[model samples]
Target: MVEPTGYDLLLKGGRVICPATGVDGIRDVGVRGGRIAAVADAILPTSAAQTVDVSGKLVLPGLIDTHGHIYQYVTGRFGLDPDMVGVRSGVTTVVDQGGPSCMTLPGFRHFIAERSETNVLCFLSAYLVGGLEGHFYPNLYSPDGVDIDATVRSAVANRDLVRGIKGHAEIGGFARWGIKVMEMAAEIARRAEIPLYVHFGQLWGLPESGANGEDADTILERVIPLLKEGDVLAHPFTRHPGGFVNAEGELHHVLQAAIDRGLTVDVGHGSHFSYRLAKMALAAGVVPHTLGADMHGYNTQVPEIPAPAGTPEEHADDENHPFKGQARFSLTQAMSSMMTLGLPLDYVVKMVTTHPAKMLGMEDSLGSLAVGRVADVSVLDDVRGRFVLRDNEDYRVIAERLLQPAFCLRAGKRFDADSPILPQAIAA
Candidate 1:
């Protein structure tokens, strides 16, 4: 009898790591019609149409960034293209964090999401007014903007693309208004049976006032009670007055209590989330349940720092300082940071891939390389070197470097890195 036809593409001789299964052995991955057909000790060269040898390199599941803001791309900033920043950097899925809301979802659905090569998901902002508005406060607090009924309608209408609800509850800036607004969002999420993604503030406090008012402890106290098991506490490591660290420079019990109660903690490493807090939390054994770039146009520039005096009005884009230029931390950079904190590579990989997928309730369909799963794959050149990984202007040592994607397969088709794709592919 004739042997069955082999796969369309085969990745050969790489150390395949499946964090879900705790498998980290050299293996070959076979792909057919954009699905992972097989992973084995070795697949003969002749069993596939094309083969790329990835000898001596580490192969893990394509990363899934749980937080980011890609809407800034439409406004002209330097954020890396989602596909390039993601697929090329070994990240296959990206959740656009609160970039779009009810009013702007259509634009995102058409202009950004449809045209991108990356697999993009969205966490709809609780505010109907969208993040790109001119006001410092998002319109969500406005009666017209905070219409939970409408938000729910929109979420249900676009259930396939809308993953959950997102809101930023910063203490001094918008916490007072945001608390009520997010409550509405939570109600809507509950009705829709979706998770709620909250960016809890550190500077703003409970009564919601003070220079370092909102501490992480207080924020967690109020927010944790409102959240269900699957709800996310994004940016759990920011070093603001109420962040992971207390005034005494110790890990706060409140933060630990929330985690213990099943609140999923995500390191949404944006412009403001503090590296100090991240280091402390890691040291305290608080591993981030997920990792995201929080990438926005301004935040995409590598080595992003404080803006010089009097540049332009456009710079005032996101009140959040870190999203102003290319973020200091890329998705891979975030993973590297976790590795430096003593997390094994497999565990770190899970935080970005499987964990986020499970958090979003898309695990069976998206995160793993199981047979019949979507053919989303990223290949990397594991460049060996020692380097520093920085976040929000703080630096840490990374003993190795992971080169960007050599090739990406999205939905069973190879994305041509050289194709006249707009927004040039970002270097890995």
Candidate 2:
């Protein structure tokens, strides 16, 4: 007869991978009162009220998506529901990239973060307009639109939710404001004493008169100096201009120096991702630290907006928009892309877990299954077979292993990976 043990739940026989604790084997995790109570080779089923057999599945610390855009409704159609991309997609924590400005952060905290099941945080936008219409209006993002003092105050006051600052560094912005916007953003980040996450690919359309002496290849060189240690350079493998790959088809010479200067990289794997550029960067020894799906309503399938007569939507076709009919995406899909690029599975796992935790400065509370920590765990199905992986450029590769989210426990509450936007793999 087994003595009564006080575990509320026991996850038995799962291949647990917690890089932070250096555990990568079969283990039984015991949870009590929403925290990890024990992790051992054997935790008797009778010791817990509920025992979940997770055999043949990969159990890991819950995923942390570092570049989510889940402001919802307020950011127009661009924002997604917090839970849709959060716990429902097997991600325990999501850091919304540039969704809430200092002015709109209060609503984001009350409506999105406070009420959500998953942990929601933000890299507060430098622009006062925030992510309105998906940053569609490029005119609103000029330096004049940024209030450095107010933004700094908001970030300081809401240190609990605002982890960093978000700004852009692409050619379009450079041509318009000539790096003044970045200068202001850097100042705000400095005052707040948090990292600044800068977008490094083409976002806004360039000025009608052209670059006006602005060069895409030189954007990184100019922007890197303004950034300090712990600051992030996002979208290194972007298909768009002003990324790690220069116009000459070679990796930028400044990339190594930037990384050496304690600057980190994030694979903001959005529609801008390019398999070709990713390969070039990998060959050039530029590996990103964190991976985020960067999913929003525009990239994935969402309700079609009823536009006014003769708008771009009326004439849009698949040819004009290459990614229109592509497969849906998630953080798991981003991990698979890295795996296909020849990165080790464990390394890819670290990108979504430990690396993101460090990026958010919440390593102690998030990203690990250490005993006494919150019971945030992810269960993934590591399906081994030939599957087709495609990028924004429509480039495809055959991958032998694909990781799919089975479920996740967020603060001890279970949520299945049932988001409609979860990708369905095509046979190779």
Candidate 3:
């Protein structure tokens, strides 16, 4: 009798949904040698060394987070552990948004990316300071602080890890330095030939002298022309100024035009999210292409890590400060938020999987469950119940269904989804 050539592991009888590959149905996934061996309607249980029944669960291409701040210890108290926000949270890949600059890329690569079980990537900071203390000091992010040539060189030199360029076009920056900083960021992204991811909410406090004749409502128009087709406009539903909505509470007309011009949108859903604003934007047909949890220390209830000596202390009285030390959130919760806002489950899945892969320009390797691809899969419990979801502003909505991560496979290795930061579903 001949021995059966079998897989190393198999996930059996799960509702597999791979949007990029156009597959949505019950399937069995076989993994061997750290790649997808097969995804068929049914593979005999005997065909694998080990098999786990996943009936009534969702099996998808591993989730990818487009915005994360995981430069732990180096960025004061603002960064979280990569694995805490990655595989342990049922996400396979995390793109650290603006955490590493040219000066810090080497440390980021060696200490953060290589040492972690989860796959880590970066959006090189356009500024030299590079997410220091979550970009807290307004003076450090000025136009004069950007070294375009150095940033471009760093991005090009580290193409394997750096996917895009991260910068801001918010009201505070506009009031401080006008559009010079954005122009420099655009130039760096252009030179590197990668997508530019721009934040569109208030990141810095305004100058004491006020708006300086620069209006928050007009910031998008000025920045849009500077951005190329593949550039990203993030924080569409931010409660802060300089987001997708204009001063009159209407969706900015220029937003549709930016989309028409091939620009992408990302829901940098953090403490910035507002359900009311999300509804308005969705009603105006401005769906985001990608969804990111934007998890960092300030907005999450992380184990307290004392800031390094001489590090700037967090001032508690800032009126615009996000709720600190009290909330638990994850990318799965962001997906639930979209569903609560009436986006179909399939579309929401795409926002975290396929769409994010495309945004990272990693289509061939990361987005699909096609055979021969890396065996990075996410298994989720598709719970059906009445759950109450809330946002930063304390607005609430009831959702009939919620998707929670169960576990994930990264390069065929299993990681249980058990991050302490994962939010519990409050019964409605």
Q: Least lDDT summed over 10 consecutive residues: which range in candidate 2?
A: 302-311
Worst 10 residues of 3 by lDDT: 316-325
Residue-wise C-alpha lDDT for candidate 2, range 89-151, written one tens digit per residue: 989999999999999999999999999999999999999989875234678888889999999
TM-scores for all predictions? 0.84, 0.95, 0.96
| Residue 23 alpha-carbon offset, candidate 1, angstroms | 2.8
Better of 1 and 2 by lDDT: 2
RMSD of every candidate to native, in Å, equals: 4.9, 2.5, 2.3
Q: How accurate is candidate 3 locally (lDDT)?
A: 0.89
| Candidate 3 C-alpha lDDT tens digits along 271-357 | 788999999999999999999999988777743665444433454333323445445568998998899899998999899999999
Query: Clashing residue pairs, candidate 3?
Result: none
Q: Hey, what RMSD does candidate 1 come out at?
A: 4.9
